[model samples]
Every structure is written in C-alpha cells, then in structure tokens.
Target: MKKVILGLSALCMVAFTSCKEDASSKINSENVAAAAERDATSGDFPTITFEETEHDFGTIVNGTPVETKFKYKNTGNSPLVVSNIKSTCGCTVPSDWNREPLAPGESAEFTVKFNGKGKGAVTKSITLTTNTEKGSEVVKIKSFVEADPNAPAKTPAKPVIKQVQ
Candidate 1:
C-alpha cells in the first residue's frame, strides 16, 4: 500500500511539473518598451473644461421640448476622446456633438434637448465618458415646468373600502 501511495504522489508531481510554464517566455522586448512608454506618460491625461456645467431653462410650459448647447474645451496636454454621452432619463436627449478626438486647446459643443414632461423644479444630468483624468464628467439641466392651461384635468381616483370579516 505504501508503494502504491508513493507511486501516485510521484505521478502527480510529474504532471504538475510538466504543466508549469516559464513566465518570462511570454514577455518580449517590444512589449516591455510599450509598457515602459505607457508608464512614463501616465501622468499626461486629458481634461475637459466646460464653459457652463449647469444650465437653467427658467420657466417653461409642460409638454414643451427645449434644447441648449453645452460648450467645452480640452485644457490638458493630451487629446480628449469622448466615447459616450448618456442622460439620466429618456425625457432628456443629447445630440449634435463632435465624435473625433479633440486636440489640446480645441473647443466643441453638444446639444441637449429636454422634453418638458415633469412638474416644477425639474433637473436632469448628462454624463460624458471620456479619456480625461477623471474618466467621466457630468453636466446638469434644470427647469421649472408650469402646468399647461389646455392640458386635460386629471380625475381623482375613487376610494376603496374593505368590509370587516
């Protein structure tokens, strides 16, 4: 029995040794140089400087759509790449923006449309995913939606009463 156990252990050791790989074999000179270059320029990150981070549409009628332009500039040493723009809700839509990489000191603008569907003091945010130092940035839109005079009046819900058993 001890001989059988020793033979099994030896077999397992051989299998593991054969499966082992040399970590240095996967790395090459080109890969090392690329990694070094990336590390050396890691501090050079693009920055987004918005002319106005927030915009207020003032008083607007409910159900009316409104739009505004948000201007920005690249104020860093690296190029700025805005990969995506997302809104907090479907009622707000963003469009008409530059899709190319913005060089340092270049300016760009995007349009944001808000479908005035909320009540008073409505606020929404649009997030931009970029290659900036912070990776992402946020802009806000606000408005006071007044009730439309022509809108149909909402009927009050009827109360339900439950009888005691």
Candidate 2:
C-alpha cells in the first residue's frame, strides 16, 4: 500500500512539471514571433495596416472643415494598442481615441478634422505610434481650396450696357 501511494505522488509531480513546461514553451514562441515582426518593421510598421492610407478632399470651400476617418484592423495574433496619434498642424485635430485595447481580430477608428482655411493646395500628415511590434506609421490627408469665395461665377456675360444716349 505504501509503495502504491509513493508511485501516485511521483506521477502527479511529473504531470505538473510537464504542464509548466508546456506553458513556458507557448510564451517563448510568442516572444520569438514578436521579435521577428519588430525586426521586419524596424523602420516602419509593417504589421499594422490601415484600410485607407490616404484621404483626398479634392476641393473644399474656404472656412469649411472636412473630417475624415482612418480605420485599421489587427491581423496579428496579439492585441493592438495605439500609443499616440499626432497631426502635423493645429488646424488638423485628431479626435481623442478611446484608448481601448484591440484584440487579434478587432478594428478601430481615428477621426481627423482638417480646417480648410489656408489657400492653395494643402497636404497634411498624421503620425500614428502603435505597439504592434512595429514602431510608428504615417497617414496623409490632402486638400485643395480655391480660397476666394467670390470668384467670378460661370454665368454667361450680361448684355452690354445700353449705349449712352
């Protein structure tokens, strides 16, 4: 009876040790994958992809504000966390992100507003910093404005003034 009890205790210890090793192996594998991804995207983010990399507001009237949305999804096996988002100019304001963690198969939205006050062609860029093994990303938003609200209308020339009497 004593021998049987000792053997069962040994078997239980072996099972626990095997489970611990298995768990450790899984964690190590994840770490390796993350490191590889980081190396691949050393300069720029390759794991994090945006649905629309650019937004073009062809021609907007002066004083008008145009808002655009940038959407992205997490295609990797880990959670996606956006660390920071910055706009090049003050006129371009990015809405506050919820700062929620995105799971493996999730999506998020970032809203950006462009003030079309400046004249001529304007091109602005938004920098996104994330924790998807890659470091940061840049998304561009472009707009063209005529500025002059009273530009000559395309109406046909009015009849010439009556000749002086």
> Compared with the true structure, what per-residue lDDT tens digits does model 1 show for residues 85-149?
98999999999889899999999999999999999899999999999888999999999999999
TM-score, predicted candidate 2 vs. hidden true structure:
0.61
Whole-model lDDT, model 2: 0.82
Q: Report every candidate's CA lDDT.
A: 0.96, 0.82
lDDT by residue for model 2 (100-142), tens: 7778778888999998878889899998888765567889999
The reply for model 1, stretches above 4 Å from the true place, is: 12-26, 152-165
Worst 10 residues of 1 by lDDT: 19-28
In model 2, the runs with Cα more than 4 Å from the true position are: 1-46, 151-165
